[model samples]
Target chain A: MAGSNHTPIKPVHRARLDNIAVVLHRPHFPENIGAVARACKNMGIFHLIVVDPLDCDLTRILKMATHASEDVVANMEVYDDLAEALGPFNYIVGTTARRGSQRRTVMNPREVARELIPISQNNRIALLFGPENRGLANRELKLCHTLVTIPTSEFASLNLAQAVMIMLYEIFTASAEFPPDFVPRLASSFELEAMYDHLSRTLAKIHFINPENPEYWMMNIRRFFSRMQLRARDVKIIRGICRQIEWYCEERVERLLREAGVNRVDPEGDCEDRFFGGE
Target chain B: MAGSNHTPIKPVHRARLDNIAVVLHRPHFPENIGAVARACKNMGIFHLIVVDPLDCDLTRILKMATHASEDVVANMEVYDDLAEALGPFNYIVGTTARRGSQRRTVMNPREVARELIPISQNNRIALLFGPENRGLANRELKLCHTLVTIPTSEFASLNLAQAVMIMLYEIFTASAEFPPDFVPRLASSFELEAMYDHLSRTLAKIHFINPENPEYWMMNIRRFFSRMQLRARDVKIIRGICRQIEWYCEERVERLLREAGVNRVDPEGDCEDRFFGGE
Candidate 1:
């Protein structure tokens, strides 16, 4: 439990939070709406949409929302229909507590928060919360691109504002960028392909690999190098070693021929026989 | 986005929840107390303690606690003093909205929840919340071993129940264990040193590294291989390659010497001269 005094503070991507709109579909209580607004404001979310609420009493809502979240309540949009409310958003995530055969795909809030980071860059995302008494129906869920469930105990029922608070908390926390551990740009596919080709030829020339079915041995070589995630400089270093091996092998063959007083020789065929003869 | 139908549900450690108690110090409203109780029950935390409340009406508290959370309200503890209320708990976390020089060690709720998992296993942990108008004072915070602040926007004021809900939600969700992604045992320092030594000799024999200052070049090589986080099997593979290179260099030098009718030769000196002479 070290103090966070030494820990670096991560920068929050505020624009992502701005892109998220909290839509309460068919909410039953005005106090819950106000509470949701406060939760949204607490987590840096401003867009609050209420669709066809049973009660839209501003006094009760404002009471729970308090003065701090009044702006969220002031600019909040009220819609007559759920589909019309979600029309402007590019992506919709429906929240549900009920699990059924029909609701096959359900993600937890943390996973949804992480996944939304990329999508929120260019899209308006809506987090749709259903009425307190009954969660989003299968019909309403159909409009959603994804589904999220807040994990709870055997008493799995959560308050409307509580659910909203949890979901928003995750998004707000996830929006922060972790302290960077810089990894340099790795070699491109084209550069890697050329290096691998050069390595294949050099290994064959040295009789370190079978010329026949070279691809089989190359597969293992590829996996090994892939794990390294070699940068361009590493690729160049590997290629230089291959070139050196080729030069050494050619020079040895020429020196041997001169010593034996042999004018002509199939270097490849002769070297293969001489290298593998002992084996 | 893939459907979570394939995602396995993680089991929540309920005993951890049982170990957590939510303490309200000098609360203003009974409604907030009731809401906090519901929030605790929603997230599987049952223990609720109130200390020197402005008002503690059972009727008003029960109204917000709802029938679902009645059991939590029935077993709630009330205390006149904060210090006496926190006596049974081994760890006390004070929540604050204000940041100051004295309160330099503030953690967000998520970090606190994650940290509490191990501590909660053997000890009782208390999450202390202050009154609605002013959060925990510096004097009250002194009683706490650690301090946590709910991260919020410019409008930092958050409802008491919302704050309680967020803290409990984090604990409940974090209690679940994630699916394991196993990493095999890596090569020990002794094994890695052996591989590096073998590699150094093999590279020198092939004239791929400068023998005069091999360690300088070996530093870069070490960094490259370290990035791969080599396993025991990977170390074995690398050592095997070094052995192959050593055998190839030796075989080539031996055959060349025999053909030249040399009974014994300074292999290292001759190889160095022959290899680097052209360069």
Candidate 2:
């Protein structure tokens, strides 16, 4: 296969570090925030988003961040809500030290970085970190499509800044080369949440799932669908099916009432209240 | 090729992180020393040597190092001279943020880490870091056998502790034994087919798909689920939903039939044959 005339072709697309936004959720320390900025700049990731920081003292953050990363700190976006902060990102990777049955499908930083190469080219990616003390809670983790755990020794506790540094380091290193496979743009977290909400309501109406504990049952459905890495079109297709189910159920109910010659005061209102209320 | 008896042999030798020593030369702050200690402990590197630190305030260092890393601080070695501090080390890897003609042969942290793994097994390796303000000078870098430079953006400056963290992280990750990626077994073709058949029948009953073109509509669903590589448990969940839909539709029809009191021969039979005939 080795021919003297052979010339290596350059990859058309490479991992876009610019597309990556480092999201720090509820960081307790301003110093860590500054250090995280420094780490972000060092790794060529410019976008930094801080969600509900306990302390937003510029002096303390700048002291650790140094002057080089001032631009990152200056350009940083602050948000009060994690959901709104993650709304624009197409893919979110949550960092966690603790592993559980719910977070079984975790990838190490290196593995995730490699997997993200193709995805970063087409979709905006978010590297989410929880507060310094406790990591991303289960509720917060629900928003993340993928989970990343940094492998460590028995002494597994890593400083918030250190965790950010290692993760960015892996991504920066991996971004040097391009993989052949290309992942197309996936549905944004906003779109996906909307689809899931609609699906939950539809499934609940059909009595396919218990509305009292929808999230419990919905978690499995979320995992199954997340595995598909649904695009915007896929979300639309699923929502379409949910709509059809709603329509079919209501039409069948109306037809049954009409065929019975029941003198119900308002058949449409009764069925609408039961199935399509609060829409 | 058909041999059934083959036993895998474990490697006889592996990298020993214990043989590595982190040497900080003329570090400016005690907090960085403490943070470096923490980084070292996090990655399983125990030996730490500080040569002529600007201030060796134990309290300030410990404050940053935290209680988890007290042992590392307790056992840390302090020296007045850099040469004396690195006397016992056989191989030295100097970390520098600046590049010069003399240090042209610089390897990124990841590359250097891989190279050090084998050497770390038999020889004492020293990872040298200079002051926070200025990196290892030419005179100091002369003592190092290899030079490592953490790749950075235009803002190449990295905190002293952060630099130490990245270097140690690379070495720790390179030395660790990683198994192949964990991929849980997927649902067998038979299980997937059964779930698909159930789903097709359910969708047809709901009028979500035309009965005449059920296969055409299901092709899209099949492709979506195929991407997920559904596990056996996931397949079961989908089938359960199908069964629930069938039950809900039959129950609703029977309730409507009873409420209207129109003499339909058998409501259950009518709905069952229409929605759940094959099953």
Using lDDT as the measure, which candidate wins?
2
Alpha-carbon deviation at A214 in model 1, angstroms: 56
Q: Which candidate number has the best TM-score? A: 2
Q: Candidate 1 regions off by >4 Å? A: A1-15, A176-279, B1-15, B178-279
DockQ for each numbered candidate = 0.20, 0.42
Taking the tens digit of each residue's C-alpha lDDT, what string does model 2 give over A5-113? 5977655444689999999999999999999999998989999999999999999999988888999999999999999999999999999988665645888898888
Model 1: how far residue A28 lies from native, Å: 1.4
TM-score, predicted candidate 1 vs. hidden true structure: 0.60
Q: How does model 1 do on interface RMSD, in angstroms?
A: 11.3
Candidate 1 Cα lDDT to native: 0.78
Q: State the lDDT at A51 in candidate 1.
A: 96
Given candidate 2, what's the lDDT at residue B56? 95
Candidate 2 wrongly placed segments (more than 4 Å): A1-7, A101-103, A176-180, A263-279, B1-6, B12-14, B265-279
How do the predictions measure up, each by TM-score?
0.60, 0.91
Best by DockQ: 2
